[model samples]
Target: MAILIDENSKVVVQGITGREGQFHALRNRDYGTKIVAGTRPGKGGEQVESIPIFNTVQEAIDETGANVALTFVPPAFAKDAVLEAAYADCQLIVCITEGIPAKDEAEMYNLIKNNTKSKLLGPNCPGLISPGKSNVGIMPHEITLPGNVGVVSRSGTLTYQAVHELTQLNIGQSTCIGIGGDPVPGMSFIDILKEYQEDEETNAIVMIGEIGGTAEEEAAEYIKNNITKPVVSYIAGVTAPPGKKMGHAGAIVSGNKGTAKAKMEALEEAGVLVVSNPTKIGKAVKEVI
Candidate 1:
């Protein structure tokens, strides 16, 4: 079973009238996601791709019994969209918009921290897919399949690259989560790791990390103490120069901290098999599993 979503999830689009929202809403619905309703301020009472639109999230939830909300609103309005979803009692909210201010993200996170029933995915992420069952975000659904491997990553394109390699080697995944490369993303590597550890369908895990933050290092420590499943990890940006931001907003090296070598060393110490090369991710997983 998937962690955050599955075949039974009733989803709603928060910015359904916009170009990106309409496009992905149709794609996700075609992939078998139960998209029950959508929200667009002045476009209420209209329909896009046959899904009814509402002026507010509460109205959409009240009318459609929507438990999941996907936000494609612009970055400036993303925080309010997320808050509206949370207040409307959407159990799971996935914000696909990128470039949201860090302070806004922090505030949105704080608003939902005490709401035990709600969970957020990303503000600059590709979202997660439980292959063969449901596709939530913009990840190419055609490349994934149902299997025993669970994959989680901080980078979106890198997550796709690793999944492609695994698929080529006939290593299908139970769930693949792109947790966003922002400094203060909604979910942490350890959070996804714990879910995978408890999932009976998952046999092994692949973690893809990049240089910049100590998230990988912290995850390694958690694995050393609590995880039992075999894990293979890949840390990107080994050749990145110090103090320069990489593609991700969070990917920056500061002196000796947050370096690729440092993260790899920590993972190795935690008994995780670390791969230095991206193309070798699948090979490393095969060796471990």
Candidate 2:
């Protein structure tokens, strides 16, 4: 089965009165996700595309039995929004806000890890799509297909590119998760890797990483010991200079650590097929499986 979300998920959009919240929520609904409820501080009793709006997450859940929360709140209020979802016991919380403070994100991440049963996807991620089943965030569903390849990525753009290429090669995916590229994303590469390894529908995996974090290296260690599926990987920012901050806040090289070379080398040593060129990632996956 698909990881994280599926056709049965009933979603509540936090800050659903906002432009981004309305657009993506309705779009995901059109993609067949259950966009059942929405939360706005004072916009209760309103409706966006017939999705009922409530004053709070708990209210939405009480009214619609919403098990998933998609957040489009501003950076300043992102942590509060996530907390609301977590405390409401939403099974899956996908936060799409990108400019949240690192401290705020870390606090939210830790609380979800230690105190709540809710699984948080991202604070700056593009959310996920279980193709032909559900779409929960801003990703274009046209580029995906229902198949056995599970994809996880740190970059939203790269996730789309990898999925597009895989679909082009006629290899569809089971579920694709953009775990976000924030310095303190709620979910990690290792976490999603475990889910992918356990997902029966997933026969292979594609991972898109960016330079500037030790996450890929950590995932490599876990994959070596745990995962049996063929995994193809591409690390972006290969040419980024040390101390240079790349597009994403987490994508920066420090001294000899967090370099693309180091991440690629680690994954290669772990028996993962690491592709040097991002464009050839789909080909690499095809070769392995």
Candidate 3:
């Protein structure tokens, strides 16, 4: 029982007529996701890769009984797409679009909180994959394999790197979730950590976190008190000059609360294995076993 998605999940593709949407939807279908319906505004009668397209998410859900949604809408309309999915009662909404305005995200966040029962994965993320089950996001299929460890991360490329190293070590994962680097997306490190801790197939966990935010600290607190599974974590942004911005704007550590050093210290004190080198993640995880 990995988090968010599993084999029984039936998915709908939002913005199905667009090139990106159609391509990934077909790919997801091929990857064993039950992609049963699609949404494309006025192209309601069209069929994309044999899946029926509808004018609204409600229409698609009604026709296909799709409980999950994979959205490929443009950034400008991404919030609207998510809201539509949430309102349609899609149990899981995976938003693959990046670069959503903060204000738009706030409104969407509030909408999801107040009105929708749907659980959101990401607005700027690679999405989640449960091995031998379903993959509904943009991550490459070849990198993952079924195993005992569950992977959760904020950085997309860094998540890939961790998976690659783990696969090389022949320790594949039960599920991997790229919760995204965005400030206001759905899932956080603590959220995924709770899910991973509850997952029976997952014997261990690997968390890839960036240098900013109090997220890692919060996760460390959770680990100290609740998480029982062996956890190995890597925090990025070690080389960035103090007070300078780096890759993701949200990755800058300001004030006393959100530095890489501080986060690592917290995790280490919690009895969580915190690795200094990103390249050594697999080896670090192996030590726990």
Candidate 4:
């Protein structure tokens, strides 16, 4: 059982006319996701192979019942693309574009978070996948093996590495989600954690976070109180200097807050097994499970 998506999800690519959009949407569709329709204003009435393209998301949804939306537009248009999908009521809206303004990210988050229409995944994310069930975004499907472990990560690179390592160790995952490293990402660690906690097929959890925000610390607190599942965690940017932004826009450290050490301490206090080395993520999950 996957947390958010599975064989039942029907997807619509918002920027399907673009190169990246066409590539991933087709890749995902070929991988078994039901890519029912696509949306690109002037390219309406066209086709990305067999899938139909509509002028608007609502048209796509109304025509094909596409419940999931993935956006692969440029940074400047990301906010509008996402808001359009949200208004069209895509059950799950995934924004794969990076470099969106923080204010724009916040606006989308606030509006969507307040609405019951959509559950937004990311604005700079790799999207998510339920191996053998469905694949969305750019994460390769070959590295995954279907099983029970549920993975949630802030870093897309770490998410892939963790999944690959787990598969190498013969540990299959039920679902793997890269929630993106943007400062104002639509979803948080706690959101995915809650879903994992409620998912009956999920027996253990692997949470990967990085330096930047108190999200990891907040998730630690949530795990302390609400989740009873065994958890393994890895926080990146351990040696990063204060006031310097790392690879991610949100990966910044100020004073004592948002440091890797601080996040590690918080998770440890909540009884989570914290691994200092990123390479040990698979081993950590193996032990916990």
On TM-score, the leading prediction is 2
Cα misplacement distance, residue 9 of candidate 3 (Å): 0.7
- For residue 238, model 1's alpha carbon misses the true position, in angstroms, by 0.3
Q: Against the true structure, what is each candidate's TM-score?
A: 0.97, 0.98, 0.96, 0.98
Candidate number with the higher lDDT (2 or 3): 2
Better of 1 and 3 by lDDT: 1
Evaluation by TM-score, superior candidate among 1 and 2: 2
| 10 residues in a row with least lDDT, candidate 4 | 108-117
- Looking at model 4, residue 81 earns an lDDT score of 88
- Top candidate by lDDT: 2
Candidate 4: stretches off by over 4 Å: none
**On a 0 to 1 TM-score scale, where does candidate 4 land against the true structure?**
0.98
lDDT (CA) per prediction: 0.90, 0.92, 0.88, 0.91
Native-structure RMSD, model 3: 1.2
RMSD values, in order shown: 1.1, 0.8, 1.2, 1.0
Between candidates 1 and 3, name the one with more favorable TM-score: 1
Per-candidate total of colliding backbone pairs: 0, 0, 0, 0
Evaluated at residue 112, the lDDT of candidate 4 is: 82
**Poorly placed runs, candidate 1 (over 4 Å):** none
Which run of 10 residues does model 3 get worst, by summed lDDT? 240-249
C-alpha lDDT of candidate 4 relative to the true structure: 0.91
